[model samples]
Target: MENTSCCIYTFSPYIFLNAYGGLHGGAVAAVAEMVSIACARTVVSKDKDLFLGELSMSYLFAAPRNAEVIVDASVVRSGRNVTAVTVEFRLGESGGVVYTAKATFYNMPVASL
Candidate 1:
């Protein structure tokens, strides 16, 4: 199993809206994406030119309020050109999961860019 890395980000009141307030969908997606990239950097043998191929996320529950958010990603599959990762975001204190996502990264040559 590939090693996993974790990141903790702080959330503010403005991140939420309606009754269930704390981290909008877009915000969660952003964090999940960051987690995926971090995981890819840790697992993938390629350079930094790789691009995120696809992302899938599931919002499990509402996030906590005025607390630090934690994100973690684990390597699921690794290849010479592609890397798959699973990521999750949760409340720092309670460790309650708020969102989960999967991302695939593909190495893109700099000449293609």
Candidate 2:
């Protein structure tokens, strides 16, 4: 299957904001994971199972509430047992990068039952 290279996410006030009224770190991490998995799924064969092995993120700026953010994820490396993806979160349109993440996924063949 062809993988989607990028997607847009809109932060809801209730779901994405922290008590301080900024985008929550955990929420950002979750989105990074989702995007990385989506990118990894594009390159793997149908029978192979992909699992997230490691995820790391750097927060460069605070994301504003109720804004549309762009998430771009791409496969940086694909190997026999592992795939690495990099994801970036940017504010609407030309806004600066708010966060960046790297995710590693382990690719394993599914055992037939």
Candidate 3:
């Protein structure tokens, strides 16, 4: 509950696009990573730094221009040295799942606080 985040993302031409005029894969991954990190940070200590260890994404459907998508990110587990998060993207109107991602981050302690 406390480790979750939800936002609406509107696809625009300003963002990268794929050959099919849908959101680019890299752009999708970037959005997923950003949201996941925010979710993970809710439980992670500020003195530590999060290094993205792994990110896995699945693009289920195409999100075209001007399409609004609901992005949801949640922390699965936040350990002392690792944090795991899951992100989902769905069409805002139809609620069809468009993308899914899972990311794992390694927590490294800062030398000075």
- After superposition of all CA atoms, the RMSD between model 1 and the true structure is 3.0
Residue 16 in model 3: shift from native, Å? 2.1
lDDT of each: 0.74, 0.81, 0.83
**What's the residue-level lDDT of 82 in candidate 2?**
90
Question: If candidate 3 were superposed on the true structure by all CA atoms, what would the RMSD be?
Answer: 2.4
Clashing pairs in 1: none
- Candidate 2 local lDDT, residue 55: 100
Q: Which model is ahead, 1 or 3, in terms of lDDT?
A: 3
lDDT of 2: 0.81
Query: Each prediction's TM-score against the native?
Result: 0.76, 0.85, 0.86
Q: Output the lDDT of residue 96, model 1.
A: 89
Q: Give the per-residue lDDT of model 3 (tens digit) for 1-113.
A: 34555433554444578888888899899999988887788888888999999999999988977788778888877788988898999887898999999999999999964
The sequence of per-residue lDDT tens digits that candidate 2 reaches over residues 1-113 is 22346444544443568887778999899989987887788787878999899999999988776766778888888888998888888887567899999999999999989
Ranking by lDDT: 3, 2, 1
What is the alpha-carbon lDDT for the whole of candidate 3? 0.83
Clashing pairs in 2: none
